[model samples]
Target: MFAAIIAAGVCSCYYDSEEGLYPSISSTCDTTNVTYSGKVVPIFANNCLSCHSNARAASSGGSVALENFADVSAQAASISAAINQTGPLSPMPKNGSKLKACLITTFDIWVRNGKPNN
Candidate 1:
């Protein structure tokens, strides 16, 4: 899936394997203590805002605003479901792999940890 996302040109490479790279996204929290403020916001800011936020007038799912922690936290259940979408439906940001596996892992952890504010 990661390969396909990259191949489809949905996300750009922030660092190369040859560069002994840094993670594509940055967050204050790690896998052990994921939280909305520290871990999840950065992912959405970099990946999802192109379409999901007010900055873009062409995006869907406008019923919810994803600009900040408070807005996102209010939509916690929706965030969880999107992150874990199945079948034909893709997760948030529609199609983008800029977010590394570690980032997604942190999101999973945040959901598992009850979507804390941090």
Candidate 2:
């Protein structure tokens, strides 16, 4: 019985905010090049879409279909605002962790750089 319980617990999924952020931030993303092809799409794939993508039957928020680059390009500002919004009901990934500081910095740089397509 104890072995079965331990097996069940080990197989269950959990989100680790730090694991998702700092290493991915440094390795895969460059703030200087925050384009749809790079920074934003990957972040959405790894974090947001598990809950927000249309592929999930339980997805919320109007089929935000973030499975591709074009979707992200068109929705950049809205995405940015949602990520940065502060209040009782801001719509982010809804993790216990606040969006990582480096992640926010990268988004700001991306916006400042004309929201490029690179």
lDDT of 1 by residue, 33-54 (tens): 5667766888887777767675
In candidate 1 the C-alpha lDDT for residue 35 amounts to 63
State every prediction's TM-score relative to the real structure: 0.54, 0.57
Deviating ranges (above 4 Å) for candidate 2: 1-30, 87-89
| Residue lDDT tens for model 2, 14-104 | 2344343344466454455566667766667766787667676255645676666666667767777777765444567765465775676
The whole-model lDDT of each prediction reads 0.62, 0.64
Taking every candidate in turn, the Cα RMSD to the unseen true structure, in Å, is 11.1, 13.9
Of the candidates shown, which would achieve the greatest TM-score relative to the real structure? 2
Which model scores highest in lDDT? 2
